[model samples]
Target: MKIYIEDIAKYEGQTITLQAWLYNKRSSGKLHFLQLRDGTGEIQAVVFKGNVSDEVFELSDKITQESSVEVTGTVKKHDRSKIGYEIDATDVKVIGESVDYPITPKEHGTHFLMEHRHLWLRSLRQKAILRIRHRIIKSVRDFFDNKGFTLVDAPIFTPNACEGTTNLFKVDYFDENAYLTQSGQLYMEAAAMAVGKAYCFGPTFRAEKSKTRRHLTEFWMVEPEVAFFDIYDDMDLAEEFVEYIVQEVVKHNREDLEVLERDISKLENIKRPFPRISYDEAIEILKKKGNDTEWGADFGGDEETLISEEFDKPVMIHHYPMAIKAFYMKQEGDKAACVDMIAPEGYGEIIGGGQREEDIEKLKAKIKEQGLPEEVFNWYLDVRRYGSCKHAGFGLGIERTVAWICGLHHVRETIPFPRLMDRLKP
Candidate 1:
């Protein structure tokens, strides 16, 4: 029977055929050890000259790295194996031969590996990262689904910018100008008005010229909006939502985390009630750290990193200056009722959100104050005009969160194909 490497333990002691590729291989005097991978997992296939026919033994010895083959073997229990199981090969047939694969079992430069990212995914480390990423995505959906939040998709091609026009990716929408969405928060607000609680999960684009490790030209975001929710409610939800995602990943992707060498202890400690500090307090921390930051200035990468180092868990900095925040954010006397959740270990801010301004006149005045196109937001204002209630939401960057969870230094490896300012190839 045909079997996948992940289910090899179920057929122990039975001869099964595995459609796999040669991941690596080595040979002793009369025996060949072929490292095989079938996408689900990897295993060592031992081919002995005395146990198998001469043809099978010769074929196993000559199989190159990444060569596709059908390996028929007895699934033997091996207590000391990395996967706790091994395949004793009885026959092997090469379906295709791969000669000189670019990504060999050696260290490669970041640029070289990025150029070959299409093929580089087959590597064990890359495979593990992608698998963990899959779990993260699934966990996100499951968390919201169980919490009674409906999935509402936002448009990729937007009529106006959601965050700001400075970093917008503009496009020619036939006769009128359009832009790729920077966030789905605004559309999600409308969905929440109709559905009570809703979220949008999709790709967003930003035409930023930043060359930092945390910046991506195009990335995925999950924005959750809830009607009749206040700033404090938003903070409470953010903490619980993040903890749920981290715990779910730790539970399901333990083996993948081991492959990535992530410290599970750090992830395990991420529980509800994350440290929440005010913006004024965060500024004091930055000043004490010798950073050249002022109270009114927005926090950059350096500022975020210094502040996040104060705690082992994610930190929430709230009550930012109104002038520095988005126009839709509600005002608390003199400050904007907004929050930014900085990830621990210098990963920077993964979540930014606040209670939205629900008053139609205040929303319009803020739009005019920010010098935004008033005509495009008429529909947005209509949401407030037609019985709008207090609402709150937050957007979480998927790549940044995945990088932090997987203990990766950069965001490029978190996604299958990352679109950066300079990269658009395979």
Candidate 2:
């Protein structure tokens, strides 16, 4: 009775019971053709007036789209069927009936579909995107787990801001103020010192007001921190990690990829040893491309795309100016302070990481130079004061990565329930 929709293909010449919802139906006088879907797949059921009882025939005629039903049918091979299988229904029992579904099998506007995202997710394309997202999440944990990286959970509520308070979502935590975490890198750094290597994967929040296809107020980020690692080692790990995730999705979700209409050739070219470029070199390349960018400023979205276009695989741009990077990033001599590596092919900075300053005196001076309260980060500074080793880490946005791999224009379609700056619902 609880058979999957996919199992109907092998049940030829036998009576089977299926519980599903009516996806579509066509009636020709006394004959009826019904399409049933149960999440996994869809199957066509043919009901004839003369082959079944009057009650069953009438029930099949009255069923509407999305009406939940239980049907008893005999399976038969049909050459005309789209899936090479058909069911001849002897009985039909309607369990639930929807009043009037808004979504039909026709084209609809993006705003309309996003407004009705709850019901829109029942469509095939949305289902495939969510499934691929799940695969990416699984692959992330699997890669870190196999590499002996401990899974450390960072607190959603924190006392101090990792970057700054400008774009942080502030919340009232009892009497004090707490903000939603923007990245798990800081907390994972301490854990990495304790556990040798650690990674944290969870939802992060940002109060950015930008309405871009690539931006989200609430997104998932996976941050991996390692002690005794330098910027070069960090870049190497980032490339290999990204390559593994892409390979896993390609290996396991080929059919889902096809449903999403992704060009697998682009992802096939994504592998380890992504092209690495320094901040100075990227500036030179951008200058040649007629981009009005300076050496110290961070790369704009368009500039990042242009630089990534020059390489076949993902590109890593490292050693950014200290003033342009986070306060915690270690300064490289007198030229630059931090390093950042970006993915090529228009992925746009999939990995943001750098070497952290481990010296207590240097970190204290840098915190003051950034005009941040040292008391707020006293605990963070304790790591450097007591026993700290050279450490490096990076945060990879899960939605952006999935959108790039699946070739989706908008990041919202990649997640089942996307929480944007203005929209937050089913």
Candidate 3:
């Protein structure tokens, strides 16, 4: 009878056929111990010389690492086994022979592993991280679906850039120029007016030239837009959304957490009502910490770390200078005051959002002030031209949020296939 790797624990004292790849092997004369992995889990199989035929014993002895094989064995309950179950092999047959596997049971550098990512994904650590990433992605959709948010897909190809033209991947669209989307914010806003609340979760491209841990040329972003929502409501939604994702990871990915060696205690304190501070207040704190940051300047990486470390929960830094922000953000008072939120524990700003200027005239003026072509954004400006309300939304980088929850240093490992400035292949 054929059985899966996970079902081996329940089939004790029964004969079963197992198909898997030989992860590792140990042979001591007549006794053989083989660790087999079949994607679901790993199990130890013991093949004694007397328990199997001569052909089976010889095949097990000569089987190379990662060789695909099938074995008929009797399931046995072994209390001393690491995986809580073992298989006593009675018959073994090689299905596919793998000669000179590139990845051995030894350590390799990051560059070398990335070059061999096709096979490196089979390793225990890489497999665990990717599995956790899948869970995170699932939880994101589930959360939004549970809420009344309609899923709206934005276009991958756009006639004009959303942020700026400097970091856009220009492609020829039958004589006209098209660029990949850097954020789905503008599209989601238009959808929100139609659906009340809408979100776009997909790949966003940015042709950034520098190679930084946080910057990726192409990455997944989740942008949610809500009609009739202000900056306060935006922060409330952002906090709750973050808390939901972190709690989901803690509840479902215990085994993965163990593999990553994450200190669960740190994540345990990540509840809602995270610490809130104004941009001006954070600047004062930075200056006290000897950061030398001015009120008009955006928070640097060092300043962000110091501010986030002061609190146990994620910090919500609001009312950033409008002069340094996007043209769409609604200006507060006479000076520059727009809302932004930053996560604690040095994760930096995972969300950038604010109340968009509802008045079409003011928005156009701001666009011109920022030196952006008003003609290219006429479609976006249409949202305000007709029945516009005080609406707000934020863009959350999915990779950054996952990296923070998993306590990973680099964002590349959060995604299965990361496209950085230097890497494009598997």
Q: In TM-score terms, which candidate is top?
A: 1
Per-residue lDDT of model 1, residues 82-121, tens digit only? 8899988889999999998998898999999999999999
Off by over 4 Å in 3: 334-339
lDDT of 3 by residue, 275-358 (tens): 788888988899888888887887777787899888888888888877777778888874333555666678777877777888
Q: Which ranges in model 2 have alpha carbons more than 4 Å from their true place?
A: 80-82, 335-341
Candidate 2: the clashing residue pairs are 314-344, 315-344, 322-337
In terms of lDDT, the poorest run of 10 residues in model 2 is 334-343
State which candidate has the highest lDDT: 1
Query: Candidate 2: how large is its RMSD?
Result: 1.7
- Provide the clashing-pair count of each candidate structure: 0, 3, 0
* Prediction 1 TM-score vs. true: 0.98
Give model 2's TM-score versus the native structure: 0.96
> Cα RMSDs of all predictions?
1.2, 1.7, 1.5
Per-residue lDDT tens digits of candidate 2, residues 266-326?
8888877788888889999999999989767878889989898899888888887777777
Residue pair clashes in candidate 3: none
Q: lDDT ranking from best to worst?
A: 1, 2, 3
